[model samples]
Target: MPSGAVRMSRKRAPEPASQLGDVPERKRVSWGILISQGSWADRSPLHEAASQGRLLALRTLLAQVTPVTKGCHANIATIDHVTPLHEACLSGHVACVRALISAGANVNAATFDGITPLYNCCSSGSVGCLELLLQNGAHTRARHAHLPSALHEACKRGNSQCVESLLAHGADPDLKVPQLGSPLYVSCLHRHADCSKILLHTGANVNVGRGNDSPLHAAVRQDSRDQVTLLLDYGANVNSRDEDGRRPLELAPPGGPSQQLLVSFQGSPRTLCQLCRLRIRNVIGRSRLKHLPRLPLPPLLTQYLEHM
Candidate 1:
């Protein structure tokens, strides 16, 4: 009608009834349109943006979605039951994860493979993302039998900061998975001395571990003097036997330093100071152990109790 306006003519608007077959997903996502969660793996543009750490695109897509679907897109699961939050967390995209979470994504959404966003964040060692999920009420512990514990994932990955965050948030330090054993055991098994030390400091039972195997046994097998010393300091049971009826000393390589340390520990006693430290920590309670410095005790005594 207008001189500057160009009219586009469609020769055919409609064909036969239901004769065009199924439309390609891209057909629905034509130019200038932003759509998400199609019929295939159920992945949306949001999932793509979140997974690739495209923060700008992710925000833009969220902006284009309708009000009802804006927050929902952050939560829609793929065929694998993986949300965009999962993708962003797994990829360690803090800003994207924050965006998804701010858009009302469920912080505790678990995948078909028993992974929560917290678990993925810990696995990726992104403390920022981990903090975001935790602040959003992500379960510090797995709520379902199918969901793996985020603390265990952190320990297995040797992420002490993540482990500490989970612990500080009330995660069970001694949670024992049937296949993975205790967090302490997995940390020792993986040679994560720092993680094990943190677990020990947080009052994890030194002698408890995966069925019949002690953290000491894991440390002995690893032949790590640091692990052995740390466990010994925490009063790990040297005489503890595994399923194979073997002691930690037996697991160490013959004539190795760990074996020699175990030999000395077998016949000797822990110092009065070490015993007192352990007793004080136990009496202080795990929940209150973090406040040891504020108890008006001597700073040196407090540091000793906290293993500082």
Candidate 2:
């Protein structure tokens, strides 16, 4: 044990709530024992097992411990309030996560720094862990101003599967952070074409980004042809100005790939099919796009809506 080890108490009373709106308040306060004087924080054997992906060890520990410390969401934590579920998700340990969830772990339980299992899983790029959390009704929200939303993390990490799962589970693609912009913009900033594509398919606003900068502008600055092409296909405004009052094309090099691509689209008309697709998508609305198949549409048209 480190010198000056001390037991820590809960920072605030737990709020018995679910779902993350504008800004999340640590919905459930968790308990932890830690060294108040050192960098090392107290962790249970269950936390160790989950973080190491030792499913069998975790299950045995779960059976041996009292119900309070048996891997429940609020049972154990580090000084920062990291639960076993948080540990498992951080390491992308699917089996450990499943076991913890089975034992009634809180998927949405946030740490002192506002880290949640969903955010951890996204950071680890684990689709399995992400899916499990969503199925358990974990709201993809963040509580700290310092951390980005789960969707933003997924986009920044370029985890298309996580992005898709988050969207399907009702993550706001347009949810903006003070410094990180929207999920779509994060995807573009990171040059994650697949993630950007997924956001557009889910009906994220093509024009939204950090304050005045657009996703197209971010893509241009990064010189990512794939991201730029995806944004253009998704109907990003070419004339959209950033806070610096420059169009995306202006940010590109004198004759770089982005500039060339922008020039090609200038004075050109989008295909009739593309125009029709955008029109239908706008009418259907973001919240209703997932239910497009259930609408009275042809199979071919539905496929177009999904892929095109």
Structural similarity to truth (TM-score) of each candidate: 0.84, 0.82
**Stretches of candidate 1 above 4 Å error?**
1-41
Q: List the residue pairs that clash in candidate 2.
A: none
- Among the numbered candidates, top TM-score falls to 1
- Give the distance in Å from residue 300's predicted Cα in candidate 2 to where it truly belongs: 3.3
lDDT of candidate 1 at residue 115, scale 0 to 100: 73
Expressed as tens digits, the lDDT of each residue in 125-231 for candidate 1 is 88999999888899887776535778887887788999999898888888887878899999998899999998998889999898999999999998989999999
Lowest lDDT block of 10, candidate 1: 4-13
Q: How do the residues 1-308 of candidate 2 rate in per-residue lDDT, one tens digit apiece? A: 55533222223232233422321221111122231234433777888798778988888887876766655533577777878888788678999988888887888887775768888787778899999989998987676555658888789778899999888877888888888898999999998999998999889999999989999999999999998888888778999999989998889977789999999987587788888888888987898888878978899989898765
Best by lDDT: 1
TM-score for model 2?
0.82
